[model samples]
Target: MNFRIFKYLIPGMAVILMTGACSGNGANGVNGNAASGSSGPNSQAPAGKEVKISFWHIYNTGPMKELYDKLIDEFEEAHPNIKVDHAGYGIFDLGDKLATALAGGTGPDLAMDGIDGGQLKIKAGTIVNLQPYIERDGVDTNQYFPLLIDIMKQEGNGDLYRLPLETDVRVLFYNKEAFREVGLDPEKPPTTWEELESYSDKLTKWNDKTKLLDRIGFAPNLGNFWYWTLAWTNGVDFFDDQGNPTLDTPENIEAAEWWVKMQNKYGTKAFSAFQSQSGSLGFDPFVGGKVAMEVSTNNLVSEIKANQPDLEYGIAPIPIKKNNATWSAGFSLEIVNNKDQAKADAAWELLKFLTSTEIQKRHHIAGNALVGNRLAATDPEFMKDPDWKTVTDQMQFTRFLETPIEAQGWGGQMWKNVQAAVAGSMTPEQAIKTSQKETEDLIANYKKTS
Candidate 1:
């Protein structure tokens, strides 16, 4: 793992853990704490007891759900004494559902959640620490990216609370046909902000008859690219050591300015009109041939394949600024804090199986997504795909974002400010400063009420 990458992973951990203090489930929660401290590799239930543990994950549809269903069947067949019952929830609802269950003194033996959500569970003292098991079994932690391991640990304590299942990185995707049509080299995508701007100018197509943009080369606001991503690439920390919003930092302001500049260059009225039409276009602008390049997740490749298999496109590292940086976030598997030692042990067995290199590789082959296991990511079969390889190569510079529990809805606010700036109602500095002040106020208000 690169040092630069690790630097971004845990910066918000301590601050995140400090804000969300949830109550433990029940008397069972005490047993959960004790198990983390005492459990060893050899700990087990009586030979004939037969442990049954339930797992709830967020993969209710598509290939991931199918893969999980298939893997669960295999797991049960191999360990007849252990019965694993699993269920899936919609992605947006699982975290809230898990929180509700824990508050009501019950939860699945195991569940899947994002690092930010998992940290809240850790702060509540209702997540199992896997460190003891790892130490006793001599599991090589190096098999995971540093951020995956880092995000799983308890703040100010070395206890690990979760194991990652899937991870993703942002990258630049461009249409090769568009590059050739513009007389630019399709093989050489932009590697810097200056080059991105230069290429966008060359690739953009204007319609004089309608005075509209027939083809947009690139737009800062397009795709999955966020304002925070640009800020991170330019070495801007969204929060300070004390967890205060630093949205108005010079680098952040510069990033905002650039975004607004692009909107202006494309003609704000025309840009806004085009965006409105594109949103209702029923397909990705890049896939629909309305945009030439986009910054998006690795999963976008599958989207392209599904919607426009004949399209020629290429993936590259997102253009860099002061640092080579990309943002990532993933789902992790965690054992719920409970009284049943046998149940916890069973959950651990399932965890190991799910994150194993073989399972991770199979999942990728089935769904075209990245998994937490480094060995699986580097498998010869997966490495052969140029797009997959391009994405995996970015793992070295990838960083995860941690949102403070108190600032749950801040993203919606920040994005509104972004729209205001890009629409020219606010200057870049004003937009960022206003967002900073509003977010700070949000945190301050929560602190006062708590």
Candidate 2:
């Protein structure tokens, strides 16, 4: 199996590849005969017969794990015929374990994971096509955010293999205290690239004698900042309509050059040294007051509340250039390919129950995550919080980059070129050109072998 393809199957911009081989567990420990039925809201299993479906997820700890278990219990109570054998796996271990299990025909009936890995499973023929079930059950795809649905259909001839579960959108997080200290208006955040640069300069502090950075205003690579987001903000798309690499476009080059310039301004070595110091001390640069502003996702709000509840902070859309766009990514629920039709039907029932508005709202509140379900996302109860409202408001402008399967390995390769440009080993134009050629070569080679 090509693990490179699975490595990019992460939930968001951060990619972690699990290379260790995992051993399979048989039938997820089923204890009873599986029962088949229509997957409608009113569907019920016959008396004296029960179906057991195994479910695997990465929410292994904290409130999310507890909430998941509680939901499973509720689901079982509502449909006594369906019993779910829920299991938790480390996020890093899921890809390899799932791949191994599916290959051995011992995988779970249903799984929730990032779209990237789900795509690899689809390509490997290890996941079921959910279109038939969706149509038969009259599942309304309209209930979900359109972008989430679009990403799920990007694989296998536009077939819907997974249902989006939750998602996060990137935004700007600023320390209001830092802005006040810098003599800038605490209520207003930078709205444009030029304004952001000016604010960053004013907010940054340095020691004249030691030549060390005292505080950083913003770092392009900090938190969840992705070069793709920056490029998109500058009116660039990394791929063309035909799914070809378009990294060498003028707008992309400009974005890369701008990032490198920001790094050079603070001295890359010094900036990295400061970042290392923060990491080594177990401190978040932003939360610890080492950095005044950062580009981060909705999750940062929870982190801030947990780490420094009293910190005066503000959330705003990421400073933009050509458009009010931000990058978005999230997880989806998929039913693994199974030989037993009964187990497949049971899994579909569970999938619908989990994605239903009430259940989704409960999950979002318990986890403080942005759910993909429109009703849950727009619920006034959850949107009452200012921070969440600010994050959710940008959904209309959020964009999801659908990477072509043939170019699955492009992310890591492109990051290397980005590093080269940041280190001054190559110009931004040269870096992008090199990355484009290498990606095109990779796609061509993959096609020949596939």
Candidate 3:
């Protein structure tokens, strides 16, 4: 795979200054780190004083939960005067609380949200820019995985308003025993979409006499809201430069329709036949000897092994259209800008400590997700893992954010529109056109208010 570097955000000279201050002549500090975390408006906390900052995050019990508490304890111990009051919840609840609290000026001083919402928050002016704090005393870009540096920027002001905390990538997980039974090679997972569909056939089997599907080739959810990845791969987009929604583009319609045809052949009824009983977390159509291949998140690897230790599976980037890519989704750390500069600065210190290489590596070991910072992501310890290394390395080619569109809940709406198309209730052509028009209308409504 070609590791191409896309220039989106330019690292400021300020990173050099922060590296010097934090990493310092102590010679062992993050001075070698290059994020420049203190570059934006109100990025730093007050100097040499105890500042209590409240933080809310979507990280709860798991490896992440443990590591997070440990990191905070260590940070508190290190700073002495800075105490972080932390409140943790599930991802969904975090977003809800942030929306409610920020609106009322009663939110935590620091908060972590899914990166997908970061764009929305920054656009709505719910976040504070971190460039000022990092300009002279921030994290350096060189110390981080370079991709992460630009991942935190906002398009309008080119401000670094958020920091990359943890990230995830998609991988193809397949069943090994199923491959053997079908007389196919289990070692080589399909690399191309065509190969995946063809390999899937080899693993699919049915009881001809009974007219029952004995096994399926693949799961039914691949096409769910993956249009962003497909759109990028095909060099098409569902929005214009003005951020207007354009789901009805010819290329988008083509990508959506192609997948719909595949679902139709598989029999929509067959895919959902067991939906009521099976529900969403269908770990394996393969493990149950029903399907052969699956493309799931890196975070699911741990659960997969725990449930089916003996099941054979391989990890690789999800199949693509033109270039190698998949959806990039993860959680991030940001200051909610409570209008108190001291609290915001203390929050920055907390963000710095949480995203530090030491803490990031600890989080990765827990198997919750990859650290959003650069150095830890590319660290030998990360890339060396047989199962997870490939997934982490693939981020070099990953898209940090999807092309922005409009409306508050437009993404979910678009997802449903596309889901209906895949579930066979609508045609791909119908789905895109309907989604595009609805999205345009939503954008128009929001623009008038602003």
Task: Provide the overall lDDT of each model, using Cα atoms, as 2-decimal numbers.
Answer: 0.76, 0.75, 0.62
lDDT of 2 by residue, 293-399 (tens): 89988887777767888999999999988988887877788776565667777888889998989889988877778888988888998778887888899899887
Put down candidate 3 lDDT per residue, 405-449, tens digits, no spaces. Answer: 335445556667877987768888888888888877876776677
The TM-score of predicted model 2 comes to 0.88
TM-score against truth, every candidate: 0.87, 0.88, 0.81
Candidates in order: C-alpha RMSD to true structure: 4.4, 4.9, 8.8
Query: Candidate 1's residue-wise lDDT over 271-329, tens digit each?
Result: 88888887787878998889998999998888888889999999999997888888887
Better of 1 and 3 by lDDT: 1
Please tell me which predicted candidate would have the highest lDDT against the true structure.
1
